[model samples]
Target: MKKATRLLTPALGVGLVFGAMGVSAQSETVTVESGDTYWGIAQGFDGVTTEDLVEANEYNPRAIPIGAEIKIPDGETSSDNDVVTHVIQPGNTLTNIAAVYDGVTVDDLFRLNPGIDPYSLTVGSEIVVVDYNSEFGEDYLYHTVQPGNTFNEIASVYDGVTVDDLLEANPNEDPYELTIGSRIVIPLN
Candidate 1:
């Protein structure tokens, strides 16, 4: 019976690894800092909801000693160069602002402007539109497309732009009929 139990222990552990729990079997260790709780640390990671954290803890909940290493999902690395400042317009809503920029969501805008209430659009307040790593150009108002340019290509030249975002900006113009020297509205970062 002792021999059987010993063999079952490793198998049970492996079974837990492959269980219904959504946590990755391969996890990286994060050190618990002062005032860091499992809930707070878990919330920091994307794709990790509260339930996932609870499930992950079931494996070794008691092991999370203060200053102990705990497994956490990966987090995004912030780039100082990616910051783009934009002045809030009178008619602008948080969602509309997010739609104007590529790779950005309303939640992202809210996160960047911590003190600004989402419900209240404070005109003239500068907000970071997109998180990227690129420099801004001097020509702020517009950009004219040159020959051999696609929506994707144009987006690549500017910071915080995507093909879809460019298309959204120019509702009247056809994406297929992008002519050279045609002016397109560049969304302010």
Candidate 2:
């Protein structure tokens, strides 16, 4: 029987290991640069979220040290076909841009472009918007609030999800004042 062996290359910041069964695992890492945020790093990878990086690294997302290496989890490779970008024009607002695109909302724009200030739209700057109807992954589902939808009504659509679960997953949202077209996270059971 063969024993598991692990190897890490400091220069490349990659970790590779092979188990007794000859199964191998590799993790890619990125060095933290100045002015980097978890949300900003997550944007470079497809199907990865700020939550995913936080959970994987177990670090304070707000206080990531400069020069620290961050492990990149296994995720889908980013493809240009999966993203749609729009250049900002004078007097353009996220609300109006969303209105021009089918199935896009202000919340979606905000979510896609983190650290964006709605009040400071820069002309010629690009922003991303995604199709809400497209599946992100099995980890969670994105649901847009409708005009007359409640937490209870949303919970009823998914099996084994309660209003409490919804509240817990979305700490920043106001249950009683859900805005129409706002997106919420629906945790999977």
Candidate 3:
């Protein structure tokens, strides 16, 4: 009887573990549309970050082809409190838009609103101001370099971020010889 009890206990524990895994593994797929970015899609769902969507699909966030089907992890719902959007006004740059919000930076704007041309501000276009539920913390955010990405371009996207700051955070990485798919740290000022 003792031997049977021991075996049953371990088997029951294993069953419960597998059951939980099955529940968490639930996910749904969505087709990528024109002008759809990973960050933009994540905004439609609450508690889901661009990183989550990217990691789940294992695709380059910067170059997701249109009409491609991607997996969106299930169980996350939309929450209005988690994200806020701002409509661009005349003379509004990412810098000035970020300035209007406390603790929001150009880096945050770039991360939240990917694929936006910093030099071209379309008046009346809406962009995400802040994603309070982002997996990244307040002090810094991590960025991965894509093909044809330059240190200067990366620095230019984030307001007030200089190549020097990126160098300081990443001591071993050479800004001039940035490697594809290498991670860079962008420190928030």
Candidate 4:
């Protein structure tokens, strides 16, 4: 029974990996820290929703585990850099701001900016928008920790990535227990 139970985990994990690969979208994982909220974490990037963060980590919004890595999905983006930092200015509407980018939207502004109200925009607040499929940019991505995540578990989903790679990439993180919603770098294949 113990053997079967152990095998089931890996089997299901493989299925998940394959299933994820079948989709057109890919994800980066990140670790959660103390006092971090879904709303706060989602604010760090453009187009990342609190619901998406919750769904990816598979945790309750109220009680997310510290050290768990969460997956942040990327949409259509392209740039030489992983992200473009845009400062919110006076007279900026979320729709108008998002209109400047192909995949960005008013919802994206809300997702990436939790404290600020769309109706009353704040000037000088920085918002980060991620660029997907950027040419010759940072190969590794920043991943958020979610429940039931380990270096091995995360690596199992990606092609040609390993626990050792994760360790090497993120020497600061404890390999045994990753911090939930904390940032971990994932090396690309």
Superposition error at 180 for model 4 (Å): 1.7
Relative to the true structure, candidate 4 reaches a TM of 0.32
The prediction achieving the highest TM-score against the true structure is: 3
Q: Give the best candidate by lDDT.
A: 2
Q: Rank the candidates by TM-score, best first.
A: 3, 2, 4, 1
lDDT tens digits, residues 24-113, model 2? 356667788787766677667777655445435634455678877787765653334345566687878998777644356798888888
TM-score of predicted structure 2: 0.35
Alpha-carbon lDDT of model 1: 0.55
Off by over 4 Å in 4: 1-137
User: How many angstroms is residue 123 displaced in model 3 relative to the true structure, after the best TM-score fit?
Assistant: 47
- lDDT by residue (4-94, candidate 3, tens digit) is 0111113356667677443343355667777776666766666766545644563546567877777675435433544557767788888
Candidate 3 at residue 61, lDDT?
A: 61
* Deviation from native of the Cα of residue 36 in model 2, angstroms: 40
Runs of candidate 1 with Cα error greater than 4 angstroms are 1-81, 133-189
Among all windows of ten consecutive residues in candidate 4, which has the lowest summed lDDT? 1-10
Q: How many backbone clashes does candidate 4 have?
A: 26
Model 4 lDDT per residue over 7-53, tens place: 11123566676774544334566677787777677767687655345
Worst ten in a row by lDDT for model 1? 1-10
lDDT of 1 by residue, 1-189 (tens): 001011111335766767846543455555656555444555556754322333233222323456565644333322232355556778778876665543457777777667878777789777776433232254334565565778888888888888787777666456786644345666665
RMSD in Å for model 1: 18.4
- Angstrom error of the Cα, residue 155, model 4: value is 0.5
